[model samples]
Target: MSKDLRESEAASLDNEVLSLLGRHVSVRKFRPDPVSEEQLEAIIQAAQMASTSSNVQAYSVIAVTDPALKSELAALAGNQAYVAECPVFLVWCADLYRLREAAKPHLGGAATYEDSAENFIIATVDTALAAQNAAVAAESLGLGIVYIGGLRNKIAEVAERLGLPELVYPLFGMCLGYPDQSPALRPRLPLPAVLHRDRYDAGETVRQVKAYDATMSEYLRKRTGGAKDTPWSAIMADRLAEPIRLHMKDFLQGKGFLRR
Candidate 1:
C-alpha cells in the first residue's frame, strides 16, 4: 500500500495484489444494484480454490437472495440493514457433515468428534480462508462486501434459518453489492509493533498502541465528521466487556464439534 493510500507509516511492499488488498475497506452501505450471476459464480470459484487443511475442504456456503429470508436474517443479526439490503448474502459454514458421509462406508459409522479441537479448528480456518478469497475476488470484480460476524449472535436461529444440519455451524455472513458509500481506510498498528525479530518482545507495545490509538481516534473523528471520537482501546474494551459469544462452546458441542 502506498503511504498516500493508508496515510500511515506502516511498512508496505508495493505490488499489484498488495495494492488491491491494502486499499480494502468494508462496505456497509451498498447500492441496490444486483450482482450478476456470472460474477457470483466466478467469485465462488475463486473461493473454492483456497487451500484447505489436509485437503478436507470442510466447509460450505449458502447463498441467500430471498428477500424474506434476508429480512429475517437482518433481524437475527442485530438488525443490520445491510444483511437484507445487499444484493447477495452468503453464510459461510464450518462443515463436517459431508465428511462424515464421505467416510461413513469405510468407517462403518459416522466420524465422531474424538479429535474435536483439531477438527473444529481446521473447519473454521478453512471456512475463513474460503470467505476471504471470495471477498478479494468480489473486490476485483468491482463489487463491495462486508463480513457480518454478528451472525453468531443468534447462532441457533441462523442454523434453523439455513436448515443447517448437525456438524455444520455458521461462521459468518457476508453482504455483497455495489457500494453506495465510500469509507476511509482504517489505520493499522506500525510494522515494528507487530513484526518481531524472531523473538517475543513487549517493550514497545504500550508506546506503539498509544500512538496507534491517537491515529485511530483521528481517523474516527474525520470519518464520522466529529460525531464520534472514541479511541481504539476504549471501543475495543467496551466490545470485550460484552459476552464473547458464551454460547459458542455448548452450541458447537451440540453441533457435533468440540465433543472431546
Candidate 2:
C-alpha cells in the first residue's frame, strides 16, 4: 500500500478500536436476559488470544451459571448482587497448576520456580490481559460486564468453593449479561499524566493529577446531584489510608504462590 493509504487504514483501525474502548463504562445493573453460549464461546476465544509470558498462558477461567453456585459466590464476593443476577459470573484465575503438571514428567522431580515471585507476576499479568480481552469482546457483542474485585474479600473461601488446587487461585470475577442501566462514562486522568517519555516526570504527573481532581470533582457533583463533590486526590488518599485486602499476601502464600 502507498504511504498515504497505509496511514489512512491505520487511522481507520484506530477509530474502530477507540470507539469501543473510549465509551467503556462498568455496567452494574444487568437485564434478566442470558448471554448465549455462542457469545460466551467467542468471548473466551478472544481471551485466549491475549499475549502470555513465554506463551505459558498461566490462566484459567471458570464460568459460573448455576444459580446455587452463583448465589454462594455472590455471598463470597461481599454480597455483590450482580454476581448472582448476571447471566454468567466468570472467575479468572492465575493458574500454575497446569504448568506444574505438564513440567513434572520432564523435570523428573527437579526443583521448580513456579513458586517464585517472577512466575506469580507472570500468571497475574497473563490473567489480567486475557480478562481484558474477554471484556472488550463482550462489549463488542453488546453484552455488559463488570469486574468483581470483591471476590478477593473472601479469597480463600472463593478458591475452595471453586475447587482450585494448589498453584491456582481466583484472581478476580466478572459479571456478564445484557445492560439494564446506562451509567455515564467516567472521565479518566489526562494522557500526559500516565504516558511518560524516556524518563519519569514527577512534576508533570502532579500537575496533570491536580487538573484531573477538578474534573472529577465536577463529574461527581453532577452525578450525585450536589450530594457529593470530593476531589479525586482526596478520595484516593482515603483509599490509601484504609487497610484494604490485607490478607492477599497470606492467601497467595497459602495457595503455594510467591514462596521466594
Candidate 3:
C-alpha cells in the first residue's frame, strides 16, 4: 500500500472502531459462512487482554458449536432461534467458583466465607469488560454479533443444561457469524441525555428522551413496514413493570452467588 493509501486505511480503521461505538447493530440474520479459526483466536485473545479486577480474571467463556447444546440453549434463552442457528454461541460467565475453591485452605475449611456480594460484583464486571472486548474485536473483523441477555431469563435451566458448578453465573451469550442482512443502527440516547460533565445531570433528560422517542419511532416504522410503533420509553417501562418478573433469585441462590 502507498503512504497515502496506508494513511487512508488507518483513518478507515479508526472510523470502523468508532462506528462500532455508535453504529453497532445487533445482527440476528447471518450467512452460512463459518467464522474462521484464526478470527476466533484473535477475538478470544482480545478478550483475555481486557483488564480484570486485582487481576483475579474471574471469567470463563464456553463456546458452543454442538447443535444439540445450541438448541437447548436457544430454548432456555426464550426460544431465540438465532442462538441455535448462529455458527458460534459464546456463553460468558461471571466465575468465582474456581477461585473460591482454590482458596479453600485460606478460608480454614470454610471457603463459603469468601463468597460475598463484593466478589460477585468483581466477577460480573470483569466478565462484562472481557465480553465487550471480544464483541468489539469480532465487529472489527467484518463479522456480526448480538448479545443474548435473555440467557439469564432462566438461569437455573441454563446452568443445569451446561452442568455449571456453584459460584458460576451466566452473564450473557453472544451470537457470531457473517452477516446475511444489514440492519440499520439502533438509535441511542442523545449525547446530552447521558454524557454529563462531572456529576450526572437529569435536567434535560426527560426532554432529550422524548426527542429520542420520536426519532426512534420513525426509524422503527421505516424498518418494520409500519407494523410496530413502539417507543423506547414505553418498551423499557413495560419491561420494568412486571411483578414476579421471571424470578431468578432462587436460581442465583442455587448457583452460590451470594447476592446478599
Candidate 4:
C-alpha cells in the first residue's frame, strides 16, 4: 500500500473523522436490507447540522423509498439498478424557493431572489455540504452510499418528477444501503499536487498527473480482475470531450439562476 492508502498516518493524527474520511469509497452494490425510518431521520439530522451560508440553509432533501418512485428514478439515472435496490434514495436540492418566499415579507418586492449569482452559488454550496454530512453520518452508522450525478442528465424531467418549483433545482441523488461487496479502494492524486503553502504551483502538476494516472491504471486493472482497460488519461479525455449536460446552462437560466 502507498502511504496515502495506509491508515497509520490517520492514527498518528488521532482523529476518527480523518481516518473515516481517508477510507471513503463510493459503494455501489448493496445487500437486500432496508434502512429504518429512525436511522434515516438520524442521517437527515446530521445533514441539517452542516454549516450553511448566512444561516440561510438553502437546501432541501427529498427521501424516496417508494418502490415505484425508486424504479423511475433508477431509470432516469441511466438505469443504475443500485439506485432502486438501495434501501433509500435521497435527492438533494438547491432550494432558493424557501429563501424567496421567506424574503417576500421583508424585502416586499425588492427581493429578486432569482437574479443574483451569489445566491445561486450559496444554495449550491449549502446543498453539497449538507449532502456530504449525511453521507459521512450514514457511513459512520455502517450504511453505504453512492452519489448519482446522472440525475442532472435529465434535469428538466427530474425537476418535474420531483415537483420542484422555480428557484429549486435537484443537485444530485444518493443511494444508501448496506454493502454487498468489498471492492479495492481507488487511489487519489498525491497531496503535493493539490496542497500549496501560499500560492498556486503549476510546475509540478503535469508530472504528478502522469504518475497518478499510472497508479489509477494499475488500480483499475486489479479492481476489475483484468476485465477493464487501464487508461485513466483516455477515460478523462473522452469524458471531457463530450458535453457534460449540454443543456445545464440553459436549464439553470430557465430556473432563474446564475443571472448577474
The reply for model 4, stretches above 4 Å from the true place, is: 1-12, 111-113
> What are the C-alpha RMSDs, in order, of all predicted structures?
5.0, 2.8, 3.2, 4.7
Task: Name the runs in model 2 displaced over 4 angstroms.
Answer: 1-8
Candidate 2 per-residue lDDT, tens place, 1-260, comes to 35465567674756556788988899999999989999999999999999999999999999999999999999989998999999999999999999999988899778889889999999999999999999999999999999999999999989998999999999999999999999999999999999999999999999999899999999999999999999999999999999989999999999899999
What's the TM-score of each model vs. the native?
Answer: 0.91, 0.95, 0.89, 0.92
For residues 1-260, could you state the per-residue lDDT of candidate 1 as single tens digits? Answer: 46355445346577556878998999999899999999999999999999999899999999999999999999999999999999999999999999887887888664466338999999999999999999999998889999999999999999987999989999999999999988888889988789878787789765688888898889988988899988888998999998878998899898889987
Per-residue lDDT tens digits for candidate 4, residues 41-62, read 9999999999999999999999
Write one digit per residue (lDDT tens) for candidate 3, span 21-104.
766789998887898889998999999999999998899999998989999999988999999989999999999888887777
Better of 2 and 3 by lDDT: 2
RMSD of 3: 3.2
Q: How many residue pairs clash in each candidate?
A: 0, 0, 0, 0
Where does model 1 exceed 4 Å of error?
Answer: 1-13, 109-115
Q: Which one wins on lDDT?
A: 2
State which candidate, 2 or 3, has the greater TM-score. Answer: 2
lDDT for model 1, on a 0 to 1 scale? 0.90
TM-score of 3: 0.89
Clashing pairs in model 3? Answer: none
For model 1 the TM-score comes to 0.91
CA displacement after TM-score superposition, residue 186 of candidate 4 (Å) = 0.6
* Candidate 4 global lDDT: 0.89
Q: Which candidate gets the maximum TM-score versus the true structure? A: 2
lDDT of 2: 0.94
